[model samples]
Target chain A: MSFPKRIIKEAERIVSDPVPGIIAKPHEDNLRFFDVIIDGPEGSPFEGGHFKLELFLPEEYPMMAPKVRFLTKVYHPNIDKVGRICLDVLKNNWSPALQIRTVLLSIQSLLESPNPDDPLANDVAEAWKEDSSKAIATAKEWTNKYAK
Target chain B: MDSDISTGFTTDQSFDAFEDDGYDDLDTNSVVSVVAEEPLSYEVPYTSLSHEQLKQRFVSSVNQIQNLCGLSHEVAELLLIHNKFNIEWLGERYLDNPARTLQSIGLDLKYADYSFAPRLLPAPPNFLCAICCDDATYPVTFALPCGHRYCASCFKTYLRMRVSEGDIRLNCCLNSECRFPITDSVYKLLLSPSDYNRYRDQLIKLYVNCLPYLKWCIYPDCTYAVECKVNQADLDHIIPTVECNDGHKFCFGCSNEEHAPCICRLFAKWNKKCADDSETANWINVHTKGCPKCQATIEKNGGCNHMLCRKCGHEWCWVCSGPWSEHGTAYYNCSRYDEKSGQEARDQQAKSKASLERYLHYYNRYANHLESARLDKKLYLRTQKKMTDLQNSTSMTWIEVQYLANASDVLQHCRRTLMWTYAFAFYLERNNNTHIFENNQQDLELAVEKLSEMFERNTSELATKRLELLDMTSYVSTRRSLLLKDTQLGLLEGRWKYNLSN
Candidate 1:
């Protein structure tokens, strides 16, 4: 039940030099599990809201991508109801060189620019495509009601 | 007593192979005379390549590209794979703009220097491998032209994973921002011996898949490939059935079983129709009856002789389908014969029943031949034992008793062709040419049945009937080829019309 040197080093780096608007704290028992929080970017609809997410490093670690999901609900086309985020780097585009910090950064940018074209939630994507302003308004409402 | 009869016969010069070889052998004067009198227009020319032969083809193609482009072997391989092994296209593109073509596949023109031969270099003091987050000064590290340095062990693990995932073209650096391509030398240095072989096999598989003229045999565990220059447009007139080195016969066009006299289009349509109709047809036959007046399909869950159409509200008897009023006082014992209402009801039912009956008509014939062919395959296995028994009991040698085996082979082949003809005829529109096609079908079927009956006789009678069996075998094979030739000509000449509405 000991972690690899790479995982320990990555954990130390994320704690010492954290990315802006992001906070990641590992669990007391399992160094592979972390509780994360990301403040929404300034100009996006989710601005001023803090979103909670859970991240777990699988056994394959650097060879495979880490699993991350939102603990709080958000009304984005790419983020589904069960908190699965449809980001390319988290799936096929993932490379071993990519770290946990970079993945969080990609999620933050996804919030800044909600791509409705490659959406995971079909209804939200349809709504977003039909009326952009209304979709943004609904996203803001969900951010206030759920993400807080 | 040989349990390996199927494999044994396949490896020998069976009747199917005789037909495949266009009857080149003149040893059997009787069989040769039967087939050689006719022109062999139904045979498609193709070549089968074993696994080693395929590898040699791949290596020679790579060498050709290397010699033409004056590029390194690794670069030439990557270029050929990227362009789908089209040497002419690669040559044209490379001659037009070498730098652009190289850049298109993520190969920098300056890659000749350090990228081709990936070597371990001492890491800079205080260097950190970002992938594994190792801050210690690693003794040796690997870096591509992109300068994204990582420890050698990490590089090996990454390359092994990608290779196992069947990725032949790998990126030089793990960093997403760097789009440099990894060379074959890098893979050779990084991957284990087993994984490296897997990578090479995957490369050849990709090469085969990308080329339209080359197709791997569809049989399971088959390591052979067939090369045919048959055009895709010719599939309508030609059923490009090619046999692999393992004697597995399959159509090169759709990679299905060898379905001659049935073009790929109608065969595909028939296969789909059968897949959709088989279960429904069986269910309708068992549980449902159409309402006589309105023809709405009604499943009688629980009811008496009194039936009501839910849609049209037509009242009739469930037993005789006569008007319930006509059943007056009979109370389900109504025995009305040829009554006006009953006749009208039966006529209405017949009108609705015709199409289903038509489909069942063709489907029943197609399925019967398929079943008979399967049973004949079992009989073929038994024929091996019968051959051995005949050899022991009679004064025949091992070669003399092969006529029974040949007859069995012809029976199976003809039955398969007969099965597909039914599927082909089901789509054919009624015309003068269709009548001719049906006549040809009848002749082949009659000949096949005769040969099949002779093949199933007891082992003691087999030795006495050898000459007759051989003659029938040759006759049945000739009939099948004639049918195929007529159908092939009919397709090419556009003489056969199709009823595609259904």
Candidate 2:
């Protein structure tokens, strides 16, 4: 049940100097699993939205990437309904040098630029590619209704 | 061999190079050049080497490549692997563009300064590994040529994880942005002797599997490779039979046990048929005759013609299966045709009996020839002993009596071909071509039996008898080859003219 020295330091660093719009904290019961909240970047359709995420460090930890998933509702092509985000660094492009701070920042930036090409939500991606204004309007309305 | 052609294959090997260059385009040219400019003195398809010899070859090649290229053994291995262990190809590529070739295999020759041997990195005052986030100022640190530094423990953990996953073939630095791969020197420095040995073994296997010319000896736990002279393209129309150093013979084309004269496809199909339980089903239909009185199937295990049905307690003759009372009265009219039986019963009985007879005819021959071949293998030992005896008793030297060994080889080859012919005959129907094939097979069978008899009657007249044995061996070999050629032609030309009506 003892956490690695690296994980403890990362948790301490994140608490002392948290990112401006992102919040990530390990649960008291489980040090490996962290509860995260990301505020959508400004000027995007999901500007005011609050998105929740869950991140867990597996046994292999730095050698392997963390298991990350969205826990809150968001209207975006890259983020599926079940909250799986299609980010490169989270999968095959992962490097042991990357820490939790960098990962959360990547997710926060992913909200700003929803890569419709590498979309997890096919229907959302189609709508966005076909008509951007309409998709953005739907995204803003959903953010207001559910993520407010 | 209709035509002989050879060209230096520098350009033809570009597809493999293109893959190394990370190009998506597939080079689809089928240009395979077999260099037979200087014909080999005597081409023996297989030469078995011991396991120690095989390892020596590997280590020596690794050392030679490492020295010639001024690179580490691991980098030379990657180059050799990329070139399919064709040392000449790797040399050409290396000579053409040394740095580019090294880079292609993920080695940065510029950074790897072989002029100065690598030394342990001096522990900086407060250097923390990004992975563990520990201030490993006191612990040993490994700084790769790529300038990425990590604590000794962290690097060891990462390497162990990769090695265990069988993903150590091309492991890279732990830096998020660094593109440099972890070299063999690092592994040798970090790992214990046992773990390093495991790593080396995996690396060797990776190199071995990439080469098309090399194949592992199929014998269980034997670590020898059968290196063929012909490349994959040359094997498109030819079946290469290879013998391992362990005396295990196999068809290199299909990696199956050696089956000559029969094409690889047919041999695989025939082997599948023999291994399955379908033969038992065929035996049931052919061997067990149902009782006429009770209709209960009966398998007569003994040579007795009288079969008594246990279910009905009715005894009858096996051939016609008539009542025991009818068979006992003087002349045994049970063998005679009886028109009183129902037409349906008579037809069914005739059909089963005919099919069973056909099956028995083929199976018996196949089983007999197979047994003969097995026995001949033991005879080979005796043949060796006899050859020594003849050499000692007569005024002849060992070289003069080498005909005995040659005869033994031809006899064994003929027996093997005869054994497969019976398998070939089983699937074939009674057609004109099949009849011709059967005639050829019979010709071989007679020659083989005659040779077997001659070999059995070992006479004291060594000189004349040895010549006779040599002639008989050649005669049997020719007959076997003719039968094999006929069967091979039929298989290749799709001459399956078996009548469905039968």
**iRMS (Å) per candidate:** 1.2, 1.2
The DockQ-based CAPRI class assigned to model 2 is medium
Candidate 2 interface RMSD to the true structure: 1.2
DockQ (0 to 1) for model 1? 0.74
Which pairs clash in the backbone of model 2? B48-B245
Chain A TM-score, each candidate: 0.98, 0.96
Q: In model 1, state the lDDT of residue B284.
A: 74
Candidate 2 chain A lDDT trough over 10 residues, lowest sum: A91-100
Cα-based lDDT for every prediction:
0.81, 0.70
TM for candidate 1 is 0.87
lDDT per residue for candidate 1 within B224-330, as digits (tens), equals 78888899998988888777767788899999998988999989999998888554764574467778778888887875777888899998787677667877776
Candidate 2, A123: how far from true, in Å? 12
Q: List runs of model 1 lying over 4 Å from the truth.
A: B1-39, B112-115, B121-127, B135-139, B277-348
Candidate 2 Cα outliers beyond 4 Å, as residue runs: A14-25, A35-54, A68-94, A101-148, B1-44, B49-75, B81-99, B105-109, B112-116, B135-137, B233-237, B268-419, B422-436, B443-502
For residue B337, what is the lDDT in candidate 2?
47
Per-residue lDDT of A116 in model 2: 93
